[model samples]
Target chain A: MSDLTQLTISQARAKLRGKEITATEITEAYLSAIDRANPALNAYVAVTGDKARDMAKASDARLVKGEGGALEGIPLGIKDLFGTEGVHTQACSHVLDGFKPRYESTVTSNLWADGAVMLGKLNMDEFAMGSSNETSYYGPVINPWRRSRLDTVVMPTTHQGDGGFVSAGGTRTARSLDNAQLVPGGSSGGSATAVSAFLCAGATATDTGGSIRQPAAFTGTVGIKPTYGRCSRWGIVAFASSLDQAGPIARDVRDAAILLKSMASVDPKDTTSVDRPVPDYEAVIGKPIKGMKVGIPREYRVDGMPEEIEALWQKGIAWLKDAGAEIVDISLPHTKYALPAYYIVAPAEASSNLARYDGVRYGLRVPGKDIVDMYEKTRAAGFGREVKRRIMIGTYVLSAGYYDAYYLQAQKVRNLIKRDFETVFAAGVDVILTPATPSAAFGIADEDMAADPVKMYLNDIFTVTVNMAGLPGIAVPAGLDAKGLPLGLQLIGRPFDEETLFQTAAVIEQAAGTFQPEKWW
Target chain B: MSVDLQTVKRVARLARIAVSEEDAKRMTGELNAILGFVEQLNEVDVSGVEPMTSVTPMEMKKRQDVVTDGGKAADIVANAPATEENFFLVPKVVE
Candidate 1:
């Protein structure tokens, strides 16, 4: 009866099954919402209006026949990174230049098999590089959240008799001309943005470094980067083979758990995909986390971190303690080496993984005198600045003479980082606790960090280590910042032990409460 | 450890990515900054530490040498930017 746009996947599934609300109604609600908000948010790069209605119509027929699947009639946004048959499945890079995939990615195919209706492809950082979505050749997806101007003293530039700072008359984060915009964290930014803005129920996303978690944290959505091999890399575009993993960015922890269950499966194609059965992660969630050892890694308490973030971390620790989970201060000494090692390892692997876009088999191609000239010309025209920077860095690190010093040494440090997590986990630390990011969502106008590459790289400080160790991590929106933006607390778990992560994340969710932006988009 | 103009040119050539003279100058500064940040890794003691290629300890799963699936040349070449009769077309190399 009311607006169906904001309903979570699980909630919508129940309503659709019960016939209280038809899938068409919810799908139409989201489509109309996209019509209203997408101009400002730029979340959905392509909206499949006809496909969604057809799927919804088919789903209603299935429901009438009692032949619905797990995610029957649920509309979802597929990240551009995931291949969808006959859809515009570019990885938000100019390099891929308007090419649609003839085959579906294993992850999307799995979701479709479960009867999920497709909304459209969402935006992302180019080839899943960059923390902010700015590197996308399609342009950055502006964050829906903005710094509330209610408390700020806006200094007037006009002639004022007194030297008093004036106010801008109680402005909010509306999509007005005067309001400054913040960025939804990236490469999974569009997925996070869509979920938060109620564009789709839940969107598929992948995390190479902090892509999934950081964006979810910034947008106040829940995102989980499952254990490395939990989801297959089969048809998804690879950024870094060992580091990239697909996950769900959802409105709540339960919805994320449900999506992950269907999204994860062992495929014959991906040899690295684990053969273990997919657990009903939703069943383990909301189970009491009492007697669980939650490790508070002292290394995450980095210098120059905002006071509010430190306070939030302490609050999370206190909440866990109150819930009867033991909060112990543990040491992850090799944590400092994580970002450096990650930058090296990710780009090195990316150099090889991204080599397939050589103007040969697929995607864009520019003509030249010879094949070599064609490759150089095409790559030069195809890739964005950030993508090129990474390719060059990757080429450098993996180059002769420098390989052993940069890439090899980084790999050794990677081993030490993994050892740190293993040591803590071995000592009976069930799940580790830390701030999801150093701070809240940043203003898009703050291009100072973007200009300086390393400063932008620091945003991945707390996140890269989990990828290095190949552990599961989840970002749960705990509270809002002083600027009235959402901030999240992360829970890192042992390898393939996503059950523990879901269980613990549920506790954090229950304690800190759910967060959603004020719907400016 | 130093990456000068020649190193940038060398790597760009190696990677098959064409960079303009202006872009090369800017890229050199950016690359230098990134290298400086990663330089912190050199300070750590990684003596006797084996390089980690993957997170899991499992070795690559082997399979029997047999053609399980093939003959989908049409499907394989469907996405090609340039192709003729299922063969990807490139500039003539011998000439």
Candidate 2:
């Protein structure tokens, strides 16, 4: 009862609707903390544990007939780019090897019709193409945050029973720390290392650029993305369809506003979703963002950025000016051509949504001497070398003598980075702030980001101008560096304003507080 | 605006994907360092900028020439690597 994987999905939906915890004991305490931290955080490439205990025994018979639903028996995870009917939806790509869909991914069928539960899939950045989930083929996921060792020794402990801590004379070992292995930032690096190592009570992610807010600002947690047709990319996996969307990564900011009010809706098989109406974003967290306005931008203070990400962007602009808001420095001047115009419109729409992986229909296949040498030896043995350097830089920027010099001059520098956030939210901005990832989580094949691919696409330079201005961003965490890691910040909003980014990331998560990774996974 | 090694082996043969000759000579220096970092959008002037086409401005939601869906031919070849009746088998293109 003390550590059902440290609760929070609105405290395990109020102890599974007050029957005091029985959605199969928080789905066997997140399947025994994902069987003891999934062999050091490889973050669930698939562990449906009999479909999460038969959907936590049908959410304990719909919580004994009170008929529950907003994430009924919680559990979550899902980001191997969504799909999940037969499970393993492979965007973690070995060209979808061993694929399995038979449908189900209108955002995990709207989080399994709101009763949630799945606890599987979760590793990404293969098709969702890297920011740093080390372009996974179900391999590199590890960041249960490590880097903090100047010969560490912090004994005094005492918080055990799986919320971690231990020592107080229970025989040493409270913090030896530094094992190196950093990178949790990514294509939702396994949903920010399974929600900062609690092993999932909230997961499902996807972004496109800044894949779910730079892996929820490198594993501190709380993502967002939304507002590019606010969710419903009809079953996820298709990076850069005008900067992909889907949200949630949780562990605060009201469990990412109750998992984006049940992973947003409006489908008709995704005519770019947005049919509107999705607000109880956990009823706007703490609600009073005083007189709002926020903004700050000054071209996101970029150059060499890191005085602890400009002292955590001046403590998230002094915690949203001590919650009474109105900060305003503004300017967004096409923010450094939004990461070289999002590496030319996300590899020119990832070379036409990866030309539907050409091995005739489904997953992998490599035989040749015909059908264009079996679609060039099954996409050269099914992608990965950062998906063939983004399908050869999205087929040489949509070829034909460089489609008007790199995809229509990177879509007119993505319409001047969406007219510099529509002239700062048409002046009188209600949310912009910045600094999500210019630094903080690194090292996992980090040799200057494996010797440059635009230095790992400049880790989405402060979250790709909110996915090139379709708007609504987020990120959160906002502090902790000098090697203790976790930094975050970013806000952005407007355009179906994700409730002013969960009411200003709950006032910078109530003044930079909620960060968790000390449990050396 | 770089990309050489014969335009990275002709854009990996128009992205069908195989790229050898030493991975098209290391993807012609990683596609000329991502086309020299998107050639910094040619120092932006975007002459009367427009190109965005749709990041959200709507008006494209058409739907009428109905069919709606189809009888799942085995859930669309279930995950075709070689299927037969459910169709997908390939490799011998018109020869």
Candidate 3:
């Protein structure tokens, strides 16, 4: 009765099982919240209100029969990247305009099998190619967290002819914009926002080059990019195939664990899905991390990292050390090159995978004099600027005479990056800790990030190495910055060792405490 | 390693995406910035490193080549912009 939307997935499970709340009631609560908040947040691209109600009704019947699945009656947001049969699954790209898959993604199918209710598709970077969520075809999702007005040092009252802003005096003033609109960190920005704002108990998100973790850190939620192949990529829209992995964004570490348990499974449809039993991640939530060797990678201490982020990293180390985790300084020398290499490798794979979007098969079609012209026109019209930029880079790298210099070189660098993690992990490091992002969430359409694509790409610097290594990583909200925005610390685990991440992240979550943005919407 | 305007146009053509002269000029600079960033990969000695074919260490899983799924022609073409009797309609390639 006390705002059913506030209940974590684990608590909702108990309450639903106890018959204290009906699935329909909770579903309606979330629907009402979404209806009210979505207009301001732009989180949900398409709300499946009718389907959610029908699913909740079925869940209620199952509960009455004293039978339920692992996530029975829990409502969740699906990233638009996932294929949900007969629903919008565009990966937030215009190229897939009006496209609906006839089959569900394996990850979503698994969630439904466990009784999770679909609350509809969430927005994301078009083709999962951006870090600021500004690349979303649906307008960028607004971060629920805002910088405190009291911390304002500069404010712009009027827009200049350029992207810059100026005060009425025609000069920049030292006052921050009053509650400036901030971007929810992206590609999975919507998932992070929805979970952080309590619009959904949890949301499914994918990470390729830190899509899940960066946004989770920005929005103050718990998100994990499980080991590559932990969740089948069968129906998820392909980004960088080698780096993409589906995970969950939830309000708490325990909620994230529960959602992940339901989201991950080995599927025959996806050959890359590992043939291993999915562990009960939630069961390890409160496990003590005594004697756990938490590695502090020295290479992650990149130059010009904010003092606060560095402080937060130290806080994480101190918390883990207090929990009896032995802090060991380790070196991953290839860290600086991971982002640059990712820029090459991710775009290369993305270009090849996106070739299927020719106007012939599905989605948008533009008329031209011939088939080739039509394909060119359609693609040009369909893709956004960032998508086109990535495709261009991808195509250029994989083109004749450049493959060895760019694509091949990046792959070799990727191997070195992965080997760095292997060396540290082989040396008895249980998990590694670092700041999830270099800084807290910044303003939507911030000038610097907008001027240059590379500036935006740097947002994933701390989180991409895990993807390159094919390891599991989680971003747990550790503390608030001076501006009241949340900052998160990431924990990287070994392959198929998400249970260890859950155990370690839970410790940090407990120590730092859960964060919730003050509801401005 | 920076891409020139001509190279940008060529890459866009190879990618099957049309680009206007103005956009191509702009992309030349953007692509150069990205290429310049990734050029740092040349700094590291990758002489003995093998390009990663797969991220995780696992043998490719093989399955029977037999058709296990079909009878969904309508579903397959359901979202296509133009379709005729389950066949996708496309602009004439040879004329």
Tens digit of per-residue lDDT, candidate 2, span A1-521: 48888878887788789988788888888889989989888988889898899998998899899998888888888888888788888888887898898888887788878898887888877887887787888788988877775553555556777778666743333335787798887888988898889888888888877888888888888888888887888877887898889888888889888888778878778887877788788777888898888888777787887778887898888878887888978787778888888887888888888888987788888888788888888888888888888878877777777688878888888888888888778777888888888888888988876877788888888788788888888888977787788888888888887887898898888888898888866
Model 1 interface RMSD, one decimal: 0.9
lDDT of 1 by residue, B14-90 (tens): 88999889888999999999999899999999999999977888768778999998888998888889899999999
Overall local distance difference test of candidate 2: 0.83
10 residues in a row with least lDDT, candidate 1 chain A: A169-178
Q: TM-score for candidate 3, please give it.
A: 0.95
Q: For each candidate, C-alpha RMSD in Å? A: 5.3, 23.0, 7.2
Please report how far candidate 3 places residue A373 from its true position, in Å.
1.1
Ranking by TM-score: 3, 1, 2
Worst 10 residues of 1 chain B by lDDT: B53-62
iRMSD per prediction, in order: 0.9, 10.5, 0.7
Task: Tell me the spans in candidate 1 whose CA falls farther than 4 Å from its real position.
Answer: A151-178
**Winner by lDDT:** 3
Taking the tens digit of each residue's C-alpha lDDT, what string does model 3 give over A1-521?
59999999999999999999999999999999999999999999999999999999999999999998889999999999999999998999899999999998889999998888999999889988888788988999999998874532444466678867657533332424346899999899999999999999999999999999999999999999999999999989998899999999999999998988888898889989999998988899899999999999988888889999999999999999999999999999999999999999899999999999998889999999999999999999999999999999999999989899888888999999999999999999999999999999999889998878899999999999889989999999999987888999999999999999999999999999999988889
All candidates' chain B TM-scores are: 0.93, 0.36, 0.94
Clashing residue pairs in candidate 3 (N, C-alpha, C atoms within 3 angstroms): A153-A174, A153-A175, A154-A174, A154-A175, A154-A176, A155-A175
> Which whole-number lDDT from 0 to 100 does residue A305 have in model 1?
99
Q: Which ten residues in a row have the lowest lDDT in candidate 2 chain A?
A: A167-176
Which ten-residue region of model 3 chain A has the weakest summed lDDT? Answer: A169-178
